[model samples]
Target: MVKTTGFRVLWPACSLALCLLMLTGCPGPGDRMRFDETAQVSQQGDNVCFNITDARDYQPANMGINPRSTPSKEKNFNFSPGLTVADGKLCIPPSFYHFPDKGQFIIEYLLISKEYDEPRSFVITLEINGGHIYNVTPTEREISLPYCRYVMDNSVGTCQL
Candidate 1:
């Protein structure tokens, strides 16, 4: 029967479309990630503390890659955990710190997208309202000084009075 034959072809086509949708995902406008700024900072007395914002894109909750695990695609969300002290006189290591996380998939039934491009990054300038400061890197040797700093930093990150 012609109707039966059409159903045979139609079934497979519909199934394939469904699979693609699941893979690429259908992110609505709000689903797309917003500004990807790098460091989020705050100042208290003579010291400043900052942490990276959530790096997950606006994709479906299932689409989020485990940004905190080692060798996992989600490590891409790592941001510098910067702290400034000694009177805000230095940005220290000059580079930002990236905190590592153990990746955990919220849903075992879903697969993370194969692609994990680096997250968006930006430099921020803050008026030191009460102190002086500088940036630091990730690989700098441990500090003997009471204050903390960054290591392997690549730039002369700055602070303002």
Candidate 2:
């Protein structure tokens, strides 16, 4: 009777182990997402605008916006597509461009999500016109920008240089 009970317990354990091993070779439920960054630039007169979008839509529960800081509170820019508490992705608006007087402008792109709940999450920096202009980092959670750099020249209404 003791041996039979031990075998029964061991049988379930062995079956579970085999099932786990088989599952390891297959793709996970959360492994279907392909996160990447896309940049769209448009020019209006002397002002150049750059729009960056993050394309990763699979898990609705795994998407959101991060937070950041700026020099001007009145001009404090948030995610272009806005915060993603309801949605999982963010579309960053075009960063306006004016002739730089000196130095370089640094704009940061932050990815915010609930995967890791925290403040002031992941940061990606963008350099504009040799002046540290604007920084847009995400708040709330961690995110990434696979393709995040773009430049637009409004003199032609397109991204030239």
Candidate 3:
């Protein structure tokens, strides 16, 4: 007579299922986006300051700053800023100025995916009005790569969660 626990039978079945799922489970457009990236933005006497809070599992990327003014015929201009690296984290000092009303600051960067080894682009927008920072929105991003994630950050910069 052989005495066997249920663990042996369940282990094989679970292993087989996991293997099949892994083989077939490729990242798709329906995959949930990971809003893990975070930043800190504050208004100091009509000046806005910005800093990156958490960048774990994200590769260092080139930072692009795009400033746009509403009701202006001039096209938006993009420029790459010299980002400061402190403690291996990227930081953008308070240097940009927005109008007292109707100004949009779009910060763009391409972070390399740690899991899929692909480049993922992100755009963080700061809407300013009347010496106040109103919204920090992560614009709707399209996931072009199959195995990459739609990684973006969410912060109004007024409260901590």
Per-residue lDDT tens digits of candidate 2, residues 1-161? Answer: 99999999999999998899897866776655444332233333444333433323322222222222333343333444333321333323334223343432323344444554322322333333443333333222323433433333321112233
Better-scoring candidate (lDDT), 1 or 2 = 2
Position 80, candidate 1: lDDT: 27
Worst 10 residues of 3 by lDDT: 139-148
Best by TM-score: 3
Query: If the candidates were sorted by their lDDT against the true structure, best first, what order would they fall in?
Result: 3, 2, 1
Q: How far in Å is the alpha carbon of 76 misplaced in model 3?
A: 7.3
List residue ranges in candidate 3 displaced over 4 A: 1-40, 44-47, 56-60, 68-80, 85-91, 94-102, 111-121, 141-161
Q: What digit string (tens of lDDT, one per residue) describes model 3 on residues 44-156?
A: 55545555444445554565555743322443433434444344344454554334466777655665535665454544567777656754544334112234333433453
In model 1, which regions exceed 4 Å deviation?
33-120, 123-161
Q: In model 2, where is the ten-residue run with the lowest total lDDT?
A: 58-67
Mind sharing the TM-score for model 2? 0.27
lDDT by residue (1-161, candidate 1, tens digit) is 99999999999999999999999899786575433222434434433343433423311112121321234333333222332223322222323422122222110011112256433333333322224433322111211111233222233322322
What is candidate 3's TM-score against the reference?
0.40
Rank all candidate structures by their TM-score, best first, as comma-separated numbers.
3, 2, 1
- Error of model 2, residue 112, in angstroms: 24
